[model samples]
Target: MTGHRLRHAVRRADLPAVAETRRLLRDHLRLWGVPAMVDTAELLTSELVTNALQHTTGGAVLVATLSPGPGPRLRVEVQDSVARRPRARVVALPEDHQGTSGRGLFLVETLADAWGVTAWDSGKVVWFELSDPRK
Candidate 1:
């Protein structure tokens, strides 16, 4: 498989930016001939981007890369202006808890083939990878 990449700058905390990121990932995966990855990729991308925007005061950057191999792998990364790495906690929701918050990293850890956080001098990047199952 040939490698492909897309990088998007998310500058706003508005919902539209999140939606646009999903659309961009969908289109890129389709063009890369991996439509099967759209659903999981979009879901994880939304989680990471929303987490970044909601937690940081500055903008975030989303980068999606497709690596070349017998079984191609897609890596999605969101970089924010914070060095604090996010932790995935298994919290028990109260019976009356009604909000859908605080499960982003859990979903990522559960679904992605592999995931991790890389801290840089400026900020940190939360990333996850999904391999093409059909390969």
Candidate 2:
């Protein structure tokens, strides 16, 4: 499955979109024969999608691509029409961890092989890549 890609447009940050995103990703991962990564992929996708919906107005786009060769690396991106970038805040105190918000990017940074944000004319894209699960 070289050069395989999937893209979806989300109209709003509703529960349905979140469920749809997970379902699609899970299905594609299954098709790609990488069941091992389905959990991580789905969790990361939810985090990114939730962030896009919470921070920005309008809609967002979700993209997933599988590269060529034995590695077959996978990259996922969430694009939202918002200029506000994500930042990993410092939690100096133990109580700070109890906050209800501000931990998505931290999880991305911790789990993703590489992740970053790219700005476009209308919005920005937050993406993360996962290496070959077989490796």
What's the residue-level lDDT of 78 in candidate 1? 93
Give the TM-score of each candidate: 0.88, 0.88
lDDT of 2: 0.83
Query: What digit string (tens of lDDT, one per residue) describes model 2 on residues 1-135?
Result: 558788999986575788899999999988987777788889989998988988887588999998877777889999999547545442333554787677787788778888888877777899999987776
- Please list the residue runs of candidate 1 whose C-alpha ends up more than 4 Å from where it truly belongs after superposition: 83-85, 88-98
Name model 2 segments beyond 4 Å from true: 87-96
Provide the RMSD of all predictions against the true structure, rounded to 1 decimal: 2.3, 2.3
Candidate 1 clash pair list = none
Model 1: per-residue lDDT, tens digit, 1-135? 689999999985665799999999999999999988999999999999998898877788999999988888999999998546555544555578777897788788888999998887777899999998787
What value does the lDDT take at residue 76 in candidate 1? 97
